[model samples]
Every structure is written in C-alpha cells, then in structure tokens.
Target: MAGSTLDESVTAFLKNHASNDAFEETDPVKASQKLFPEIAYTDTEKAELSQWLITASHVGSNTEDAAKAAERLSTLNTHLSSRTTLLGAKPSVADIALYQHLASVVSKWSAEERTGEQGYHHIVRHIDFVQNSPLFGLKLDEKVHIDADNVVFKIKPIDAKAEKERKKKEKEAAAAGAVASGATPTTLTGDQGAEGKKSKKDKVKDKAQAAGDAVASTVVGKPGAPEGAPTKKKEKKEKQPKPQKAAPVEKPLSPSLIDLRVGHILKATTHPNADSLYVSTIACGDPPGTDNTSEFEGQVVRTVCSGLNGLIPLEEMQNRKIVTVCNLKPVTMRGVKSCAMVLAASPRVAEGEDSHKGPVELVNPPADSKAGDRVYFEGWEGEPEGVLNPKKKVWETIQPGFTTTDALEVGFDVEAVPQLSGEGAEKKTGVGKLKTAAGLCSVSTLKGATVR
Candidate 1:
C-alpha cells in the first residue's frame, strides 16, 4: 500500500467487507498531476515552481540562507499578486510542493527570517489555503511551553589539592616516559619528590601545625615567644595634628578679562597658505561721529584670521558687523599673525549626522553700535587684561555660559558676569541683564542659533 511507485496497489483486507481500489504515487508532483489532472500548468510556471520548492526546502538552514529565501519569496509574491497559486486560477503540483516545504520550515525560522510571511501576503494566503484544505489531513501539534528553571546545569566543583596532585603526577609520568625512551631521569629534591607522594592525613596535620604557629606568634604571652615577649602595644602617640593649612581660595575670573568689542570687517581675503582659512582686516576702536578724544578715538584696523572659507561666502564677509575678543594673545597661523578672534555661532550637529560641515553665522551686534564700542553686561566690570594668558584658563571659566536663544541674541549668563562690587556688597541685586558700551547687545539675523 505504501510502495514507492505511481502504479503501486493500495490493498485493504477486512472481514465481510469489500476491498477498496486505490493507487499510490510516491512522487508528490506526479501524484498531484495524476490526482488533479484538470489543474494544467505552463512550462514557465513549472520552472518557477521548481525553483521555489528548492529554496523553501533549503531555507532556514542559517540566518543568511533564511534572509535570501525571504527576499526571493517576497519578490515573487509581488509579481504574482492577484493569482491564487504559482499558476493562475487553480492549485497545481507546484502549489502543493511549495506549501509542504514552507510549512515544514516556517515554524523553525527566527523572528527576523519570518518577516517574509508578512512581506509576501499572497504567498502567505496560498500557504494558509493549502494547509487547511480537506484533501490534506496534516495536524500540527499545539505550541509547547519551555520552563527556564527546569533546565539542568552540570558543573564540576574545583578541588585545589586534587589539581596540584594531578599536575605533579603528570610531570612524574612524563619523566618516566622519557627514561623508558633511553633518556636519563633528572634527580628531584626531597621537597619536589614528596609533593605528589604526601598522604592526605599528613597534609592536614601540617596545615593544623602551621595555623597553631601563626596563633602563638600573635599571643601576648606564649611559651615559645620571641625575645620581645608580651609585645608592648606602642601607645599611638595621640597624633598632635600639625596646624592644617587652609585651602587656597580660587580667585574669581574678572569679567573685564574678556575685552569684547564690536568690529567691522574692512577687507576680507583668503589666507595664502591655508585653504579653509580667511584673513581679514577688522576696524575696531571708535566709529565715525563719536568722541575723537578717547584712547581709541580713531578707527584701529586689526588683522584677524578665521576658518570660515567654506562656511560663509567671501562677498558676505565685507563690512559685516562681528563681535571680537580683542585681548586674546596674538598667534601666528600660516605665517600671518591673527590679532583678534572673531565670534560666530553654529547649530549643534544632531546625533549620527556628519559633523564636518554645517552653517556658521557671525554673531551680530546692534545696528547702531559703532566699531570699537566695548560689549559688557550691565553692573559687571573688571580691570580688562591687555592680553590673556593662554595657560591661565580665563576663557575656560566663562565659555560655558555662552549661549543663544531662538531670538538669535548672542550673550552669556548674567549670574556668571562678575559683579562690580566686592563680596561684602549686595550680591543678589542687579543680577541678570546683558549690556554693552553702546547699549544692550542682543539681536541677530540668524534665528534659533547657539553661539559656540
């Protein structure tokens, strides 16, 4: 009845019962054709079905293989959207073979590999239909629960004594083997020879004797005590603590250290040596129509170099109003000495984005503010240093407070701005407000930007 041939007889014998005539075809494709001859398949459909069968049968063997199968099936499903089976209109040998193969591997696939079920909707639908068809009597068992705590873990406890003995024995055996091979055995010391040969009880006795000796050594009065018998506990001379020096107070950084001033870019040109650098002559000191009697009465042009070649266009740099640190020590870059540092703000680069390039805009001051006008917060003043030391970290203390609001105003923390009065003076009064020599310097063309 179960012979591997298309013409095999399926015989049935029963008492007082008629024999049923049946034929068995071991080959599924041949059987499908013989049983359902009405379901005709084209040559192309047959070839495609064979490929799908091979893929489904071999898929889920590994993660890589499963991914490939999923992609292939999804693509096929997309191409054959409205069709019920691999071939149009009716189920054929191809459908039966594919369904059987897919059903076999579907349960074994991991969650990532099973995405094909959702991606290939038509294929999933066909699979469901074939699995539930009356012609096939396949009954899958209900899913079982696996209790994690029920697992049995096998672990061997470590025995230090046994390990030592095993190693010693291995060494002795190796030496004996070498001697048997016509090599002379090396003589071992008494201690080395006794290492593997000692009895368990003798080792225990030696351990007990060693522990007793250690206890006797610590006892104040013992029979075999050393010459310093009844060891006198040296009275810890109550540590007359030396007068602890008071911690040196850190000097507060004066706000005047930052010589913030408004400057106009008089002429901008590319730095000759560096590609991503720009050298510009900035006009500082005093604007036109102002008092021409002050120390910086006339416009003083200072050379400034900035790395803004690709960030801003050269045409826009001309006559642009910018904030500058006038007191920072001059540094030679690309053979040109940069006297002052220009201030600019850039948006914080988001996580996972390329940080090499982004928009960098100049920090703008008020329109009416003249070049050389000092920028300061109200109620905050200090003896501004002529040149800041590169090592003093004067800028490091104040740099964190620099920020910009959505309004594009570039400023610092009002609290961090050093008060003009001493520590004894009113500390809380006139705490928060930004100011400059001309007026409050808070306004910019670029909105929602932060000053770096």
Candidate 2:
C-alpha cells in the first residue's frame, strides 16, 4: 500500500477519514451523511451508526477491556444476523470500519468460533457480505473463503412475536419488582397513579389471606363444641387470576420475519388422498427430534406437502436444492401433516386468472448452498418468526413484494410493500435480492415471475 501510485490528495483523504473515528459526534452522523448524502438517514439510524462506528473503530484498541470487546463483537453479530448491512440493508461508513478492523481476525476464526454454540456467526456473515456484496465492493488482495459446510452450530431462528412478548413481560416484572420495593417509578406500564398502588394480584392475595386467618381463628376457638371434638375444616379459597392485559402491537410486516432456508429434497411421493399435492421429505437443517420431522433415509427431514404434483414433474421435485419457508405453522393436508412450504416462482396471475397453472418453477438456491443455510431477501434481512401464524396471514401480507428480477433472481421490492415503507428514503426504496450466504437465489427459467 505504501508503494502504490496513488496521488498525495487521495492519500490525505484516506488518512483523514480513518482518523474521523476519533470524533464522538464522527460517532457523528454528519460525517457519515457527508460521506453519503444520497441516503436520508433518520435520527435513530444516525445514532446507531455513530455508536457502532465507535465500537468498530475501537475493536482493536490496546486499552479496551477484553470482555467488553468480546461483548461488542457478539452484539454486532446479533445485529447483523437480521440485517444485510449495518444500517439494515444500506451500506454505511461503519460497515467499512468493521471490515477494515476485523476482516483479518475473522479470516482466522475456526469453524467452531465462526459458527459454534457461542460463535460469532453473524460476524462471519457480515465479513462475507461486506467483501462480496456489490453494495460495498471492497477490493482486497485476498478474500476469506467461507465454507458452507463448516458451520458447526445451527442457531435456531428467532421468534419475533415471542421475543417481543418476553421483553414486554420482563419490563412489566421489573416495574412490579420496583413497586414491590417502593422504588421510584421508572417504567410506565399504564397510568402512573395506578402503577404506584398495589397490584391487583397482591391486593387480592392479602385480602384472601386475612379473611382465611379470621375464619380459622373463629373455627378453632368455638366453645360450643365438646373439648375433644374435632375442629371444623377450613375452606380452601380458589386463586384469582390477574387481569389480562391487552395484546401488544403486532410486529411490523417485513420479509425478514419469515424464516426461509435452503432445503434439500430427499424424496417426493404423491399424496395418497390428495392427487394435486406431492409429499416431500426435505432436510431443512433441523436437529434430531425436531417436531413434525422424521428420519428419512438417515437424514432428519420434514414432510412437506406442495401442490406442485401437477404443475412440476415428480423428477424435478426430487433431489433438488430449493428454498423453503420453514416457519409457517405445520398444516395437515389430505391426512398428511405438511411441515414446510417449498418456494417457487410462477407468472403473475391477474384477478380473473387461474392461480394454479403449469408454468411454475422451483426457486433455486445457489449450487453450493447447503440445507439449513439462512436464506433471506438481501436488504430486508433479519431473524424470522419461529412459527408464522397461518391465521394472521403474515405471508400473504408480505408475499406481494416477493418477485423475480429480469435476470430470474428472486428479490423483495421495498417500495412495492407499503406496510414496510417507513417515512424515509432508506426504507422506501430498493430491490433486495434473495440470497443465502453462498449466492443469489434464482429460478432456471422464470424471469419477471412472482416468487412466494
């Protein structure tokens, strides 16, 4: 790098930006905004980029605490697990900082460290994405070659709805604990005065106990009974339930909440009762004893029922690497419990058109992608729900944005999804291609088709 033919101005520009991490408010969205003025970043995004930039910049600090650095890396990994870029689908100066600082260290990570039980899988994923995605276009002399088969630990997909509820309960419990201890109010669950008062459950329990004590006192002290007479029995009081709280707001609709995976079809058979459905044994990267999964030909696989029996040939459906929606609630079709849905691309049907036609093609994963590999729409990447509610129609809501580019590559069009279009340039536009860590998801011959 020292002997390169770069001019003095170029060298100075690089040096100044490298030193900008030293600036807190360069922990400054203004600097990042100056770097890329086209992206109209919100205050939240600016703050995020600022903090992560500080973290990324200080990743190799000699004075930083060892545990703190490790924690920051883990947090970064978790953050990237559901995002394509640091700013959640948009590239930023912070991503560059992360790549510049940790690429060397990530390159040397063992398979266990890269994807083990407590591994930084998302960091490895970020490194790979940063170096390879056209968004960043970093030109390194040597790029880290990530092996798809070397992932030692398979992290189960997160359930967004469940996680939200868990957090909500934790918040309420903390508030309750604070109240119980007579601490100053911190979290606001509802009305401030009401929260200050004894919780309904606590008040009810205290009243019940007091009444029970009074009854027991009188029953044991009755003088009408003989001296040796047995005491009257104490009646049991039934426990009262706490008042139910209203449901939390629904999670925002996004492609990231749908768990997509690269699945290997082990075998395909015609559904016995349903002639239009094909029951398939697919290895979707589930561990042994996963619900609705059975060992088929020595592989733990899910039994998926797809209506491709008449649309696609039996041979095409057999032994193929296709994308599967892994989180939808398993449904029984024609006496067979279908565990997952196979994604396929078909021509867009007009209002009066027949939905099930012969021109359907399986959405293809990269040639090197393995079963259980995380698949996501590029910009809309994030953790998916553990089990998507069929009743809620999450898929139906997000499916309209699922489409194929002119090149036959599957993607999610952000602008087309009005529900996800927040008030900002960053969220309103972009066609994020569907891909796994390996490469783009595509169909053999289905250009400009609808992918679901």
Candidate 3:
C-alpha cells in the first residue's frame, strides 16, 4: 500500500477512476458509493463492505490479528468462489479495498501459498481479475504474477443459480421464523402449500388413464378370472419348445478391441474447474448426430477433457493430429465429461514416482492423416469394438502394452503384457507399430516411453 493499507484503496480509486465531481465530497464513504460503483449494493452487501473495510483497516496495525484476517478472507473467498466479483460478476469498491491490502502480500507468496490446498486461490484470482480485466480498469504497475497453470488443488465452481436459490430459501426460513412469533408470512396463500395437489392437466390425465383401465379390464378378463388360467380356445394349441437364441461370439482378446483413431484437435482451453485438465474440441471423423458429439465450426466434434494442462502447452494442442482411444466409455472429469482419451507419451516412472510429472509429449499421428482415420497396432489390426466395456477391463489390460519404440514410433509390445500374448489372444507377435493409412504414430522425443 502506498501509505496505509486502509487509505490506499480509496486514494488509488479516486486518482484512477473518480470524476472531478467526486473530489468535491470530502467524506470517503459517500464519495466511494458515488463514483466507484454504478451498481447498487443490497443492504446485506453494504453490511459486508463495512465489515471488510474494518478488517482492511486492521492491517499494519499493532492490534492486528492474523487469525481474524484469515477467517474473513476465507469467507470472502468462499463468497467469491461462485461469483466473478463481490457483487456477482460486477465490480465493487470492496474488491479494491481487498486488493490494496493483499496485493503486496500475494506478490510475495510462493506458488504453494497462492494455489496449494491451503492457499487463498480465489482471492488471488480476484486480485488478478481486478487489475487486468477491463471491468475494473485498475492500472497498477506493481502487479502479482500468479501462474494460472501452477494451481495445486482444483475447486469445483459453485453454480450461481444454486447460490441464489439457497439465499432465497434462507430468506423464506427467516420469514417463517417471524411467523412463529405471530407475524403472518407473506409466502402463505390459497395457491401455496401445494405439496400433494395435482394440476388440472394431471387430473385429466389420471381420469383418462382410469377410464382406459376400465375398458382394458373387459378384454383382459374380469378381475376375478382365475389369475394364470388361460381360456379353452387358447389352451387348444400344442405347447412347443422355443428355439434358444444362439449366444453372441465374443471377439478374441486383442489390442484392437480398444478403438484408436487419428484425431485433429480443433481448439482447446484449460478446464475451468480442474487445474491440470484441458477441455478440448476435437474432430474425430464422426458423422452428424453421432453420440457424444456436437457440431463446431462446421465439423462434428467431441468435447474431450484431458489431464494435460501443465504437461502440454495449450497452443500445441490446437490444430494437431494425435492418436486417441475412441472406445473408452465417457468419464466425467471435474464437471466436464470426456468422450475420448488423447494419447500421449510419458517416461516410465518408478513405482513411487509421480507418473504425471512429465516431460510429456502427445503421440502424433502422421501429419497428412485425416480425423477419424483408423489407427491400430499393426500386427493386431481388426475391427474395433463400438464401446469398450468397463467390466471387461480391456483397456486396462491392454494399455500397458502401448509403448514408444527406440525409433520414436508408437507401438504395442506384446511381451510387456502377458495376458494378451497366449491361448485365446489374437495371434500377434513382437512389437506392432501404431499407424494409420497415412503413416506411423510417433512422439517427438520420448522414445521407449509409455503411450496412453
């Protein structure tokens, strides 16, 4: 803070954003409400602003209490978790007060302190948004450099509508409390308390169903018609054994059971809720109306979420060809459901080592290949299953065999996975290079690495 943390926010705001008319007002509170925010703060929000201002004033004082500051900041962080600003997507003077007191403090924090499990992540994000975002229009020279990709813990964002509903319920409950004290609740009315009431349409539907049931009773035999006994005419036919349906012939255990394809990443953005995942729009050659796919920029695309935010540069993920496992059942990651897996290569880590700590490279299909082109381990080529069954664990069993060769080519080494090497296994021998019609799938630098 320029002088004192308490005064800096107003001083900065008055200098940067206040109009000349605001200068005529000597009182800080009135000037703030006059020039700082265009939106009207609710009574509750006004109380919040007053409370936070008192907390901000405590900073750099002999009477300062660290625990109280942490508690207040945490509550504010929770409130801001579901909102873009203190006023839910609209900037307010309370934010400026928060930033002035915490900007220098946040600048000195290590990555762990900024985004670790115990870190004040939402506060850091709030500060960054205030300074850089056009909405606030604050142009301070000394800004904190918080790395967006280095977040250690991911918090699922709270839905704004849910928060509003919760607040509404709290207000209604407060009104009910007044009702208990003999005051009439504005909520009660003739049309209210409809817990068991049916609408006219619903009653009509029920009456129609009852009439149809009465008619159906005539043809279905009277209510007391000896339950399972058939009529004389029906019993006249000879009983015949129905032919048993032939069992489905299961495909032999093979790596080909996992459908792999050459996919083109149309665009990608970091997952809003997950720190280490990328939400991508990928073209996988699916026709229009294909399951789990949506049209994007004139192409049928699947929204895939991959845990590659820090591992892969987001720019490299755009407009690139990579191998993808298409048959894996869609899994919801964070809040987004990933329809397919983006194949990448990472070095074989020791048992206790973090497998995700990478020098990772996305396994690239040949540049000329089109999206949705069939990609398979050469020696195990066959028709891939439509969707691999989770109970079968086919992918879990076969993924260990997926590896990169000494020549940087992606392949399935049969010897590495013994379960797929014998008896009922598909007749595949040695390492089979993964390829499409255009060319081989290869990683840039991670040769002899695991491909998954």
Instruction: Please give the clash total of every predicted structure, in order.
Output: 2, 3, 0
Residues forming the 10-long window of minimal summed lDDT in candidate 1: 10-19
RMSD of each: 34.0, 13.0, 21.4
Q: Give the C-alpha lDDT of model 2.
A: 0.75
- Candidate closer to the true structure by TM-score (higher is better), 2 or 3: 2
Model 1 CA lDDT for position 344: 80
- Candidate 2 local lDDT, residue 410: 92
**Model 1 CA lDDT for position 323:** 84
The prediction achieving the highest TM-score against the true structure is 2
User: What local lDDT does model 3 show for residue 446?
Assistant: 86
lDDT of each: 0.56, 0.75, 0.73
Instruction: Report residue 396 deviation for candidate 2 (angstroms).
Output: 0.6
Off by over 4 Å in 2: 1-250, 422-427
TM-score, prediction 2: 0.49
- Judged by whole-model lDDT over C-alpha atoms, candidate 1 comes out at 0.56
Task: Put down candidate 2 lDDT per residue, 391-445, tens digits, no spaces.
Answer: 8889988988888988889999877777787666567887899997578998878
lDDT of 3 by residue, 1-452 (tens): 22212364455555764344443443444544555443455676656655656555554233557887677667766766545566553345556666777777778878877778887777887787666643345557567787767778765444446667999999999998887754444335565434226566986997899999989988676655576887655557677999999998899889988888878898999999989999999988664445677767645688899989988899999888887888899999988999999999999999999999999999988876767667877778677788998999898889899999889999999977877676455654689999875678888888889988
lDDT of 1 by residue, 407-430 (tens): 556656544434433354565433
Model 1 alpha-carbon drift over 4 Å, by segment: 1-251, 286-299, 349-356, 414-434, 442-449
C-alpha lDDT (0 to 100) for residue 288 of candidate 3: 40
